[model samples]
Each structure stands twice: as structure tokens, then as C-alpha cells.
Target chain A: MFNEYLTHIPFYEELTQPQKDLLAQNLAEQKLSAGQIVSSDSTSCKGFVLVMEGQLSVSMISQDGREAELFTLTKKEMCIFSASCLFLPSTFHVQITALTDSRILVIPSPIIAKLRENNIHVELFAYKTMTARFANVMAATEEILFVPVEKRLAKYLAAAQSPIKITQEELARKLGTAREVISRLLSSLRREGIIKTQRGEIRVLDAKKLELKM
Target chain B: MFNEYLTHIPFYEELTQPQKDLLAQNLAEQKLSAGQIVSSDSTSCKGFVLVMEGQLSVSMISQDGREAELFTLTKKEMCIFSASCLFLPSTFHVQITALTDSRILVIPSPIIAKLRENNIHVELFAYKTMTARFANVMAATEEILFVPVEKRLAKYLAAAQSPIKITQEELARKLGTAREVISRLLSSLRREGIIKTQRGEIRVLDAKKLELKM
Candidate 1:
């Protein structure tokens, strides 16, 4: 049963039979409903979280209560934030929320520590994955600093399916801006016939024009 | 002689004598003058870099020539970016420069790979260090997105020693903004008697005032 999820992870292929067995024996399965908070604020580590199904949104909150989406983890992706807790007893300042009904696998941190100790491939896999996530976060930061919001919004829309099911306030939080700013931008886009916005959804009317914006 | 640098790395203490001998034998020492570029675009990875002396500045440059400092690698710190190159071939978008005359230890990637295969402690150390750097980069990203430039500049001034040697252009690049904007802000701060600027230097006259801005 666990093999289904394990098969999707590229790192599992490199593990020896005993190593794989150890992993299978130690992992605990968890089911979470949509909108559930997985971890938040000073939460200690139970283990490494691997999303077997559904999406999880990870966000950072400022001291003044402002929040910004860092990135999202989906199927077969492991939580890089959880790995940070393995080496040191540190507070995880970020919050994680399940975006849909999800099935997750929790590998005990000590088992992970032991696996990393014994298996070079596992260690390498973890290092490479964590570094990749770091690079992605850095790229997102570059986009926030260098790219215009219009372009960012357009890119977000272009990548997303039509009829995006997100509120202006939520979009604002994701983009690190105020709801009014997002509303004003959407209003301008609506005037240009690039998109149509309703109470809790946005539909791209002209993807070509949106691409131009990007 | 290499043992001096090895002693500074906390992970070195956990290695067995044979592991330490292997590291000392395979490691190479490199000397870099201040202002030297350590790594740049499309540079292939030869090894993991460990700073044994002085500091290294890592900054990301955007397509339109905007630059932002990611973070600095100081003594006993390994370059996580370099390690990222070992698993897969990818362009390094960030440039690393020696902040001062420096000495670094280069551990051949193959040798490090071999050690990791044999020594679990080495593997654990690499994983932990990479995760730590990832967290630091994430924090820097959060600061860039949430904090105002004025506050960032103020915080920088408060933390810096008097008579900052960097030019306005360099400072602007580090702050992820245009030089003219930084100049204008500095002029305003100068008029308020918070800082004094001359040629390519800035002297914080009132740290308390700067802290207030932060």
C-alpha cells in the first residue's frame, strides 16, 4: 500500500531493499481535509511530511499580521520546512494549510536522521530537493522585487486554469499586496477586456492579451 | 595546514580519524583576492566550497541588470549553491565574489560523495548545512517582500559600523532598488541629520534615529 506513494518518489528507486523496508515500516499515513492547518507557529516536528495527494500551501506571516504565500507543495513532494527541524530544535515560523482533501505520509524524524546517516543516496536526495526548493523561493523573491505586479498577475492567471477560484483578498495575500491594490488592478484589466471578475472568481477573457502583459 | 581549516568546521569533529584523513588528503586550498569573482553563469561544479578565511558575497542579477544580495558565506560556511550543481547540471543565476582577501577549501565533489557514502556523519552535516542556508535565504526573501526599503536601509545602517565603505550604487543594488532612489532617500536622511554621506561612503550620525525609522 505504501509502495504506491513510495514509487512516485525518485529517491525511493535508489534505496536498497532493506532501506526501503525500513522506510515502509516507519512511515505513518495521515489524512487531512481541505482548509486544515497542518502546522503553525512554534510547532515541534513530528517528522518529515510527504504529500501523497492534494495540494498544500505554505505561507510566511510577518510580525504585524501580514501574510505572503511562499510556495505550494503538491503530490509526491516532501516538506522542506519539516527537514529544517530535524537537525536543530527551532521554531517553524511558517504556516501550512491543506488546499484540498489530502493524504500524507509522515516519516519519523529520527528514522530520517538514521536513513540519512546510513544511505548516501537518501542524503543526496534530501539535500538536492531542499536546495531546489530554496532556489525556487529565491526566484519567487526575485520576481516580487523585479517584476511588475501586472505581469505577475498575468502570469499567475495564464498558468492557472480559467475561472480561478480565489478571492481578491487571497490573491492580494499571495502576491504580497493589499486587497484594494489587487481590486484596482483587476478593475483595470476588466476595462481592457483581459479578464472578468466576480465575487470570488476571475476568468481570463483574452489569454493572448494576458500573455502580452506577462 | 589544512587541518587548521578542518578544525573550524564543527562537523569535522564528528568524523572518525580515517574520515578526517580522507578529507584532509582530498581537499585543496585556494586563495582569492578581494574583488575576485568566485563563481558566475554556467560555471560547472568542481567541488563544494568551504570558506576558511574572510567572507564571500553572493548576489542574484536579474535580466534587466537589477542585482540583490542573497546572503554572505563567512568562515567555516559551505556554499550550498555549489552543492546544488553536483546532482544536476543547472545555470547558477547568482554570482559569488570575495568580499576580502580570502582562503577557501575546495572538496572535490567525487571525494565528498565518497565520504558521504562511507560516513553518515558527513552526510548529516551536509544536509543540515544546506537546510540552514535555505532558511536564511528564505528569511532574506521575506524581508525583501514585506519590509519597506526605508526600514531596510535604516536597519542596515544601525547594524553597520560607522563609515560604510560601499558606494551608493552598490548599496542600492544590495537593497534591490535603483541608485537614484537610494540617493534621494539618503539626501532626505542627510537633511534630517541622521547620516552623513561623502564620495562613496556613508556615516551614520544618529543610530537611534535610524532605529526609529526601522
Candidate 2:
């Protein structure tokens, strides 16, 4: 019944037949619509969540209601926030929201904890995933501290294949800056002939120049 | 023979007698002098290292030679970098340097891996340590992005029980900013009678005002 989602996760594929059967029997799948909050700062993790489809934005909102994007989780990636529950009893400090229609496979916390206890491969996979996410978070912090906004914006643009169909306000939220800041930076890039900004789209005119900015 | 160091680590206390004996037989200790490089950006991790004494600084250097402090590892803390090696063959992107004369216990990668496979408690402890470290790194990142230098400085002062004994350059490095910037901010704080700056010390005069800055 759960063969599709189970097979989608690489770590699940590493499990033995019996272990796979156990997980398949215990795991539950939940579908979330776009803009739906999957979890909040105070929410206790239900289980280890594996993304089978679509994207989830992991962010933190400050006391004054400012939000900062930490990173995004897409298909085949496991949620580090849930894995963190196995270790400490502290509440999660970030909020996870579905950026698109998403399907998530959740193995109950107790089952995951038991599997981690009994399975060496499961334990190692969990450790590795947590470590990689930590590294990525550190890199994000470094980028915010050292890299200029123009360089960051250029890199973001270059990552997209063609014109990006994202609004300035959305871009601002992703970059952890104000909308006016993004608009001013985009205007500067447009003036320099580096990018052409439309009503709701931004087209990279000179990829080489944008790369140089990074 | 390894009782002293093993007893120092809380996780080691939970291991069975046979498991402890196994670790004692396989683990090796090494002493490093201050300023010595523990690991570099491209070095493959040898094993899970436990700091038995002193401190280690983990930082990343940019192409232009700017350095950003990530976090530090002190006594009884396991090296999360080595745990990361269990996943894929990827190089560590940060440098680890001995901040003081230090003693480290290394359980060879294979030995640690084998133990993790056989021992459920060992696996759980590893997961917990990795999770805690990830949380810390994220908090550090958040401080750098969301908090201003003055507020960060104020918080640092509030955390310390007494006067902070550090140089301006060291302070700048810790805050991930320029020495000149720290100097200017300190001067302003001194003028406002919030803190008194000596050649190598910052004595907070008005703790109440300092807390308000944060």
C-alpha cells in the first residue's frame, strides 16, 4: 500500500525487507495544500517526516513578526526538525509551511526511535542527515553575513533556468530583506543591463555578468 | 586505562561494561599545542573525536581570506565533523584549530561505526549530540543575521559573569565583523556609560542599560 512513498526515500531503500515491511505498515501519509502550516515553533514533532512530493519552507519568525527563510525541503528529503525530537525534549524553534501541494510520509516518533535503536543503517542515516543540514544552515548564515545582497540576488537568479516567476515581495522574504530593498537592488541590476524585471518576472540578460557578481 | 576520559563523557557512562572495554581498547589519545591545525577544509574525517581537554575553534575562510567563526568545541564534546563523514564522501568546508593546548580521544572511524551498528545506546547518544550541535549552529547563525553588533555585544556582556577579557580583534572575529566596527561601537557604549573599555577588558558598568540594548 505504501510502496510508492517508501521506495522514494533513499534511506528507506537501504532498509532490509523485514525492516521495510515494518516501516511500511507503521508509516502514515499526509497531504498538505500550498500555504498550509505543517508545523509551528511550539509543535511537538509527530514523527520523522519524509517528503514524497513538492516543497516545504522551513523558516523562523521573530517577536516582531519578521520571518527569515532557513532553507527548503523538497522530495526525497527527510525533515531534520522531526529527527531532532529523538534527542532533546525542547520545542522546535522554526515553522514549516508547505510551499506547494505536498505529500509527506511520517513514521511515528516511537517507531523511528525504535528503528534507530535496532538498525545501524538507520542510525547512521539519521546522523548524516542531521550533520548535512547543520552544515547547510551554517553556510546560509555565512552567506548572510559576508555576501553582498547584489551577489546573493545574482546567484539566486542564475540558479533559475530562465525568467523567474516570483514577485519582489516573495524574493524579499526569501532573501531576508525588505521589499523596498529588493526593488532598489533589482532597479540597479536593471539599470546595469544585468537583468530585466517585469511586473512579476525577472529575466537574466547576462548570465556571465551575474556569475561574476557572485 | 581510559577510565578517566571515558568517565568525562556522559554518554560513555551509559555504555555497558563490555562496550566500554571495547572503546577503551580501540580509542587513542593525542595532544596538540595551541595554534595547531586540527583539520583543514579538504581533510577527510578520521573518526569521532572527543575533546578531553582545552578548546577547538571551527571557522571557514573565504576566497579573499576573510574568516567567519562557526562555533567551538570544548572538553567532553564530540566532533560533529567526523560524524558527517558517515554519509557521502564529501570534504569538510571548515578549518578546526586548537585554541589552546588540548587532548583529544579518537575512536577510529571504523571502530566507532562498528560500535554504532551493534549498540543502540551508542547510536542514540550520537544522534542526540548531532542534534544539539545543529541547534547551536542554527542559533549562532540567527544571532549573526537578526541581531545587530551592539545588541550582540550587549548580550555577550550580559552572559559573562564579570568583565570580559578579550582584545578588539578577537571580539570582532567572534561577532563576525570588522575590528574598526567593534572599536567604534565600544567607544559609543563607553561614552554612554554602559561599559568601560580598558586595553584588554570590557567592564559593564550599567548592566540594566546593557540588557536594554539587546
Candidate 3:
């Protein structure tokens, strides 16, 4: 399973045989059910997580018990937020949960850090992913603080190339708004003939009109 | 100036003399007045920024012309969002502006990359800062998404040990809320004897009450 997981990453071809062997020797497989919390004991987080199947959400839970999701990962996706423990080991600020029944391969910290030190491809892959995700998260912050929900919803719809396969709950989580707010906005969009909402999917009917909202 | 800047960071002692010389050789300095945009040509952003003096803010400007601040740096701070260009190397997303008359040291991308490759301390510094800032930005997102403005204001107030030397405009930017809202909240806190607001400073008078709000 670990070898199979290794092959799925973009850096596999760029890694040395010893690097591959190092990973294969250390990688552990974790199976999670839907809604399972994976941040306990900080064990799973003291390394890197490579998602092999299903979706996982990395989020922050505030003092009031409200969850603010950072990003989600599916197959072939890696979460370096897991390795955040080694950096700020005393504090556990990030949470990971199985959004669906999932399998993941976790490589302990020292090996990943070692690979990053010597392997150009691994380094690039890690930094590229880290910076991009961080920027996206900040962009999400800007959008929530500055952009109105209507414009945000419209822009989201306009940006989609096909019928958006999303639950209202997921959309609410993505937009950092409540499900009722998303339901109301979808109803409004439906009334305007701008989008067609079916079970767990939103199809844009008039992209031009949706763009206008943005 | 670059050598002077290097000594301020915790990792300076860990860097070799050659690493120090390389940084000093490549580092460039810039002087800017308050409100000058430093993110142009992406020139200032092509490397690492070491804040020698004054404060700089890294923010995201949305399509609608509103600013959402990501973080701010005072003395001894560095902004790596500039190096972000080397990775994405295409899109421009973050903006850095001088919030006060400021001087900063810049080390171009190639050299910084080289240093990070060989210097464990430099590598750790870069990743540590990147991950910490990214987490803070995501936490700010969580605050905006789930935290009420009043509670956020209270938390902000309670966290201050001395008189906060910030203007309403700066505080508004930091919290990603409207200046008027901060004004109103401050006034309410003042009226309730929970705090005292002077011309450009907020002095917390009742810590216990302020903590209660949080």
C-alpha cells in the first residue's frame, strides 16, 4: 500500500531508489471512517499525510466550538499541515477529520525533512503545495471579509465549468457561511433563472447573469 | 544593513560565515514612506524581505478594490510571500505595502533558494515562518467566519498588555472589519468602563470584564 501510494505522487519518478525505500519502510497506513477525528495524540500529525482514498478536511476549531475548514484532500493529495506539529510541536492548532471513509499513508517527520533537504523535486513539490494552499486560504479570508455572500456565490457558480457537484453543507463550509444562508442564496438564484439546483448539485443556467452578480 | 538585519533573526548564529557573506552580498535595501505599494514589478517580491525598520503589511486586494490584510511585520520580520512568485511564477496575488515609513532588506530569489538548500537553520527559519504565518492567516479566516466582531474585539483588547499603539484604521485593517465598526465597539467598551481609548491608543482598564467578553 505504501509503495502504491508512493507511485501516485508527482515526485515519485524524481525520487531515488533509496528515497523510495526509505519511504516504503516508514510509511504507515491509516483507515478512517466518515467523521472520524484523526488529530489525536498528535501521532498522525508528527509527519506527512498522503491521502490514498476519499476526502479529508483540515480545519481549525475555534474556542466557541465552530469549525473553520482550511482545505480538503482526495487521492494523491498530501497535507503538510500534519507536519506542523514538528515545527510548533507544543501546540496543536489544526484538526484533520475523515470527511468520507478514507485511507492515507503517513511518513514520519525525519524522513520527509531529509528528503526535502536533498531532493529538489520533493522540495519543490512541498513548497509549491504549501505556498499555494496558504495563498488560497488567505484569499478565502479576504473574500469572506470583503466580498458579499451574493457576489461570492455568483462568482463561485460562474467559475465552475460543469454542474457543481456539492452539497449545501459543503458549499456553506467552502464559503464559510451557514447552510441556511447557502440554501437561501440558491433559492434566490433559482428564482432568477440563473442556476438550476437539484439534489446535491448546482448547474449554472446563465453564466452571463451569474457573472453579473460578481 | 543586511548583516545588521541577519543578527536580529534567531537563525543568524546558525548560518556559516559564507552564508552570512552570501546574504550580505545579495541583500538590497529599500526605503519607503507610509502608503507606498512595494509589490510592483514584483521586484520587491522576487526575494526575501527583512524589515530593518518600521512595519509592512501583507494583504490581499480583491477584485472589488477592498483590502484584506494577511499579516503585518514590524522590525526583524521577513515576508516570504514575495518568494511565492518563484513557485507559482505566474500569478500575482499578495500585496505588500508600507504601513509606516519603513526600510527593508531584500535577498533575490535564486540566492535565498540556494541558502535554504544548504543551511538547515535557514531552511527551518523559512519553513517555520511560512507555516506559522499560513496558520495565522487561516486562524484569521476562522475568526472572520465563526467569531463575532464583538468577541474578536474583546479578545484583541484582552490580549494587549500595555496601551495598544494603533489607530482605528490600522486596527480595522488588522481585524478585516470596517473602521466605523471598530470605532463603535471601542466606544461601547469605553462607555462600559471596560477600556479607555485615547487619541491613538487603547488602554485596557478592566481586564476581567474584557476577558469575559471573549
User: Could you say which candidate leads in DockQ?
Assistant: 3
- List each candidate's DockQ score: 0.25, 0.23, 0.27
**Model 3: pairs clashing at backbone N, Cα or C within 3 Å:** none
Q: What is the Å distance of residue A10 in model 3 from its true position? A: 6.4
Model 2 C-alpha lDDT per residue in residues B15-91, reported as the tens digit of each score: 77887888899988989999887776555366777898999887775656566666798988777565456533343
True A-B contacts kept by model 2 = 0.15
Q: What is candidate 3's CAPRI-style docking category based on DockQ? A: acceptable
Candidate 2 DockQ score? 0.23
User: Which portions of model 1 miss their true places by more than 4 Å?
Assistant: A1-29, A88-92, A108-128, A145-214, B1-3, B6-26, B63-66, B87-92, B113-124, B148-150, B153-174, B177-213
Error of 3 at A156 (Å): 6.2
Cα lDDT of model 3 by residue, A120-144, tens digit: 5666566546656776776556557
Better of 1 and 2 by lDDT: 1
lDDT of 1 by residue, A92-157 (tens): 257777899998888887888888777766776766676666667667776776676778888899
Tens-digit lDDT track for model 1 on B1-214? 7766787666678878888888888888899999887776656355678898999987876778665677898988877455555543343377777899999888887887887787766766666576666677777666765677788888888888899988987887687555655877899999999999999999999888888998
TM-score of each: 0.69, 0.70, 0.68
Residue A179 shift from truth in candidate 2, angstroms: 11
lDDT of 2 at B121: 62
lDDT of each: 0.76, 0.74, 0.75
A1-214 per-residue lDDT for model 2 (tens digits): 7776676665676777787777888989899999988876555466777898999988865655556777899988878565455644353367788899999988887887777776766776666666666667667665665576677888889998788999998897677555656887888889989999889999999888888888
- Which ten residues in a row are the worst by lDDT in model 3 chain A? A84-93
Cα lDDT tens digits, model 3, B1-214, are 4555677756668878898788778878889899988774345447778788899988777766677667899988777776765443333367788999999887788987888778755665665567567767665566566677788888887777668899998887676565666887899999999888889999999998888899
